[model samples]
Target: MAPNVLSIAGTDPSGGAGIQADLKAFSANGAYGMSVITALVAQTTTGVVRVQEVAPDFVTDQLVTLLDDVRVDAVKIGMLANAEIIRAVVEVLDRYSPRHVVLDPVMVAKSGDRLLAPEAVGALREQLLPRVDLITPNLPEAADLLGEPEITDVEQMPAQAERLSALGAKQVLLKGGHFDGGDSVDLLHGDGVSEFLGSERVETTNDHGTGCTLSAAIAALRPQRSGWPEAVREAKLYLTEALRASERLEVGRGHGPVHHFHTWW
Candidate 1:
């Protein structure tokens, strides 16, 4: 049977990022996908205009109901807007102890709109980080987590990844997309092993949901019993291909999304 994957995140009515992107990436990667929406985002590829966060107790109810009935293999966590939602998530994660937990730490949107509340950062770092198996944070997110203003190059990724791992994450994939360069290099650090996964950069504005897609793909494929390194590599390759194909898809006027089913058609 395919691994059952769950995405706990906000909703993207535009279908480019958040729970929509996660579910697409999960199904495209051969996992049975499920979702629990934490917020309803009214946005397009252009920008996020508004957000409606779900009640914290309701969030717990959804998690409890799902875990009680479904056989979940892995979880991809994203866009927990506030401390209440973060605490709700932390509670269930402690209760069920899901096998694989991939944390995306979605603080800001592709359009530069803030997704996570500034007040929630402490709760997220304190209560949630310790439970996750892997954290896939882009450079900006890493810098925020580490209290650094910026991370400018590939050279800083290893040290940053190590520091993030010390924060209780079992592993860290520090993405270097925000760094200006010809090649996009990502560092995977965990268990006294740090490896680099580099690929030629695909320049395209249609890369809105790349982070969500990569983390979700990792969650879907991790159930294959592959190591974190292998899962990260595969997910990168998948994202690269998706980005390469996404240029042909003109979904929105501004930043469009990568093709989640690039391999299929």
Candidate 2:
């Protein structure tokens, strides 16, 4: 059967990021996509203007309702807007114990608007991190978790990935996109293996939902692959092609989205 993947995230009405990107990535990866929106974000490719969060009880209801029916194979978690929502997600994961959980530590948008509340960071660490199979954090998000300003170089990623792994995740995929270089390298550390996946950086301002896309694709690929490393590798390749195709599309005034359906046509 195709992987049954769920995205627990916010909504980007402009269709560039959040659940929109996740669902598209899931479909492109040949997975059955599902979603539970944590918040309704008012934004385009330009920036996040405002946000309306869903009630925690409703979020729990959504999770229970879905888990009651669908046979979820993997889950992609993004943008939990508050501590309550984080707790709600934790509760569901504890109950169902999905096969794979891809946690995207989505703290901020590509435009620098904060997606997660500052206070909720602690809740996420305590409640969600331990339950996830893989935690994918960009340099800035990793820095936030580690109480550092930012991870400045690729050399530091291994140590940070190790630190994050120690925090309870089974694996860590530290994305090195912010590094000043020609290639975007990612470090995957866990399961007695440390590997780096690198791809030539595609020059484009339209890289909005790359993080969400990568994590969701990984979740979609997780159940089908032999191991987490192969899932990460395939996701990276898919995202690279998506980025290359995204460079040509004109979507908005500011940073646009990577083409999640790039492989389709």
Candidate 3:
């Protein structure tokens, strides 16, 4: 049977991110993808205007119903709008114990709109971070995880990645896209080692939903026999190529979506 990955995330009407992006990434990479929505985000390229969270019990029901029927090889967790949803998902993870879990600490949208609640940050750190197989955080999100206001230097990202691992993530992928430079480098810290993945920075304002895409790609690749490191590297390569192809595409007036089918058959 083919491998299967699950994405516990939100709904994006624009179809640019959340469960939609996760499923697309999985299918794009030849894996089956499933989802349990945590929230319904009213959003567009310009920004997020409002959010409606799914009830915690209903969220649990979705996970339970799916896990009961199929075996999940990996899971990608996205927006948990509140503490209740965080706890609810944690319970399911505790019970079913998916083989691979990717945690993307989605605190805010690229447009500077808050996505996760302030209080749920604590719940995420305390309850969810330790359980997942891998945690992916960009520079700003890394700072939030450590409760530090800023990561002044790109060199400091590795140390912060270690700190995040100590906080209970089996491994950490600390992305360096938010760094101040013309080059974008993403660091993957795992098993007491750090691997820096670099690519030429594509200068464009169409970087919305990057975190969601990256996390989803990682999850989609996670269930392959290649293991986590190779999975992440492949995902990063895909994202880089997509960004290169789409940077010039004028899809929207605001931050544009990635050209996913740039190499479509």
What TM-score against the true fold does each predicted structure earn? 0.98, 0.98, 0.96
Instruction: Kindly list the per-residue Cα lDDT of model 1 for residues 92-139, writing each as its tens digit.
Output: 999999999999999999889999998888898889999999999998
Candidate 2 per-residue lDDT over residues 1-265, each given as its tens digit: 8989999999998788899999999999989999999999999999999999999999999999999999999999999999999999999899999889999999999989999999999998877999999999999899888777787888888888988988898999999999989999999999867899999899988899999999999999989989898899999999999999996678999999898888666
Estimate every model's Cα lDDT from 0 to 1: 0.92, 0.92, 0.85
For candidate 3, the lDDT comes to 0.85
In the order shown, the candidates' Cα RMSDs to the true structure are: 0.8, 0.8, 1.3
Q: How far in Å is the alpha carbon of 7 misplaced in model 1? A: 0.2
**Candidate 2 CA-lDDT value:** 0.92
**Candidate 3, superposed: residue stretches over 4 Å from native:** 247-250
- Residues 1-265 of candidate 3 have per-residue lDDT tens digits of 6688899998887777788778877887768888999999998888888999999999999999999999888899999999999999999999999888999999988789998998889999999999998999888888887899768777887888889998999989988887779888888888988998887788777776778888888888777757788998888887777777776567666888775555683
Q: Which stretches of candidate 2 lie over 4 Å from their true place?
A: none
Residue 259 of model 1: what lDDT? 94
lDDT (C-alpha) at residue 241 in model 1: 95
Least well predicted 10-residue stretch by lDDT in candidate 1: 145-154
Task: Tell me the TM-score of model 1.
Answer: 0.98
lDDT (C-alpha) at residue 206 in model 3: 70
**Which runs in model 1 stand beyond 4 Å of their true positions?**
none
